[model samples]
Target: MTTVAHTPPSGTRHTVADDIAGVCEAARTHRAYGEEHSTLHPQVWEALRSSPLPRAALPKHCGGLEWGAPHIVEAVRVVAAADPSAGWAAAIHAPAGAFLARLDPPLAKELCPPSETAVAAPVIGGSSVPAGTTAPAGDRMRLQGRWPLVTSAPQLTLAALAARTEEGTRWWLVPGTELRVEDDWDAVGLRGSASHSVSCDTLVPAGHSVCLTDPARIDGALYRFPLYGLMAACIAAVAEATAERALEAFAALAQTARPRHATGSLAHLPAAQEHYAAASARLSAASAFMREAAGQAWHDAVRGQVENAARARLRAAGAHLAATSAEVCQSVFEAAGAAGLYRSSPLEGCWRDAAVASRHALVAAHGRRLAGAQMLTGSAGGHL
Candidate 1:
């Protein structure tokens, strides 16, 4: 499964999709190293650099593929099945690109060059930004805030910061050099994700900013999507892939790793068999649910039918997928018995990753309630 990226001759263009398999293979082979570094393996990062996957959701004029939402979700789900950290890291690109699409063309081009990569961290709960008394100077604004859970901060060239101004909430693109990343990403799972807090105290040109929910400057179906729903789909993709990996790993382990005092392999055990079947069925259903929701959302957006109720349905689908995937991972872990408990076992990693990812704000328990409320009340004005 080992694959390495190669250099194309000058003038030969390369895209993220070109490196997808190599990245997945590298991530799969170097999962332990990624966990140790609390970030993607260097090789995986390099592979992603040559990939077009990151900007898949952006308009073609911006060097993106303008992929449908369903396509992006499934691609992310497949990647996550290899390495959740890679999956999680890659999934952020769509939303990041979606935001980038709203920026003025020249600025978007300058900030998001074809070779450049960026990640985002929204200001959540409390504000860490210092209050400024002066208005932004022309096209430049100074920022001073700490954003937590910024994935892949070490590998990115830019970061999208969700901030507050006197006018309202907005998003700004800040160069990586202007921000400080703290090594505080230690967590129980998905340790490979360098999801540390980043502090910024620098000026960014006004061209690099946009209203958070403004109609995208680029006309396309992807730009029509609500940021919340896109984010939910991204996180759900990770959960779905991790669950799939756990089930596959457990099935493989059962073929050879017999239970204590068992006559045959664990695969023959009634309990293991039941667990495998049940978990597989559950994961399949969740995968279908997630894809369907994304597909429907994409369909509506393409036809200009995107509404709060539809967005709510998509969010609920993402949450359900996350919750269901976590359950499947747990089932697989329990079925593996003691063999699944060790750090050496992939099952342990899968379970940990699924558990942690399920808690992400995009797919948390509150999302389910919000979706229900939106559907019942026919309004989008609620917790996001």
Candidate 2:
């Protein structure tokens, strides 16, 4: 019953930079879709399905392209410019191929055939941010839990989750049909992303879940790979892209449309030029650092860096760049003022998405603490 898709040729490889422009151009032309496209836009889904990188993360054993984090970053940057919510979904789903790759061969084949994109949704309710209890019932596991902030819940066909049992937090997988997505993600930003809560009060067969590791040993190369950190880094990298586009938009505006307070032309003003210069540098620096960190962590992973050192670098780089990206957006927004806050302005949504999504518990201050503490105590950081 599993249907896997085949891989595209390397000659057809689409890098991050290429994808960034693609998403940006898409967003540029289809900005209105952000408000009404998730359910309505079949073309959007088709455009995403065509991306080579999302399928690249899977291992060669399963017929996946199996590209590393650099490709991952590129794909993310591509979608980042288009829509953060889309990028965020890609951040979770694309990289999960590695986790999927680790599954028992039968389990991997059963759930994901070959070449097909399998969606895994993590719900955010119960004690488990993405918690659900699965007991045997018929051909499936009886699922019971609520997952709030389930990013891209509507679009997903799989849910990778944890449950509270007699033992502890256990992971399970629920098919998309078994779950119900709540109409609750009416937030200030990323509205296009249906990151709603999912009601998990149904049956999900055991065949759906992949038990990758014990909680104690979950600290393997997979866990150490900095999933959360990468998520944050992707968010930040996208924010940087948003800032870049906003600047371009603003530059276009300044060239023709005079500022209300400025005399004569807007671009000629010293203060405006300074603002543009400063924001640009911040974005450039943050992006360069993020790319470096992603590259380093990936190289280290391939080279067999494990548990501590590899993760520490990933966390340090992810957290630092993410934080910097947020700051750069903030600085640019200041220059943009009320016009940037217009409901029609992409900056508004990008800003809100950047702030709201980056606040994820994994990417927050505690993550930074773990990075710093590990750096001091000589323990591998929790990042890996």
Candidate 3:
């Protein structure tokens, strides 16, 4: 099997921003192809794989920068500002190695040898029931089940499957080839995310399965906070990026759009100015709120403190930002008038991306409710 490679083909210093810009520049010309193929262009994928963008949150020993949630969120925002699909992919795939960092030493060594770079795709939402029947076969178990919404499934080297069994829920690390892609991720936005259904009927070694340990037990600062809270913040960052793009696109168009009765451009029109200012204010407020929430979460994590209520509050802030960003995107699109309706316009894509991203379960209505209930009861609300 081919191992995940980390060496960049070019000899140069590359930061997260540089990697994001490269992908954006490449993807900007391939939006039509991405829409048609339902995946990022091959060049864009290659650029992503060759960069250090994937292991941003893993421990230093595991080849990550060991940065906290805020850095990851910022990187995601920069990427999504240019290409929403690539931004979403970065948000999902970058911190994946952190999951393995929580594994036992022996298992972690066997699966992610220090000499190898590993790419793991987390299957977020799927049936809790056993995906496929499992039978003991020598040192391994034969398992079969279908999982959905496996982000970046095509580029993965390993799959982290949360399988339900009579014993309880267990984590299964299966090889990417062992799973078959169903090619059914036909979403209206984030088309290049490679979110597809995967069915597996293969032998997974017993050593590859383990009961998930509590994040608090992990020694890394990245695991100090609740996982969902960090994830929600990153998701909110993407929405913020979408809003920023929409607002910029609208501002550019407004400088030239002239109404029939107006002697000047839309920028001089009272209604247009009001719409632009309102949307800009909304985006700024939401962005500031998300950053503040993420900053608090990171500071607490670095101090090795687990403040559940604060984490819940962060999730709430994230949801609010997501919703607010969506509103900003819609407002900017409306401000674009007929131009926004065209598929060729960036406003249309930004609006679509915001609509889909804001609805992610982490930032959806339920997440807000969970945060609210937790705040009201002074509880952690682990359900999130």
Whole-model Cα lDDT of every candidate shown, in order: 0.74, 0.59, 0.72
**lDDT of each residue in 133-224, candidate 2, tens digit only:** 66778787787888787766776655666676565555566666767888777776666666788876876655555433322222233333
Minimum summed lDDT over a 10-residue window in model 1 is located at 119-128
Candidate 3, residues 77-113, lDDT tens digits: the string is 7777767887787777666666666666556656655
Indicate whether candidate 1 or candidate 2 has the larger TM-score: 1
Q: lDDT tens digits, residues 100-150, model 1? A: 778778777786555334222221111113232224766677667788878
Best by TM-score: 3
Residue range with the least summed lDDT across 10 consecutive positions in model 3:
119-128
lDDT of 1 at 36: 83
Candidate 2 has an lDDT of 0.59
> TM-score for every candidate vs. truth?
0.85, 0.80, 0.86
Report the CA-based lDDT of candidate 1 relative to the real structure. 0.74
Instruction: Report lDDT (Cα) of residue 88, candidate 1.
Output: 85
The model with the greater TM-score, 2 or 3, is: 3
Q: Point out where model 3 deviates above 4 Å.
A: 1-21, 116-142, 166-170, 207-213
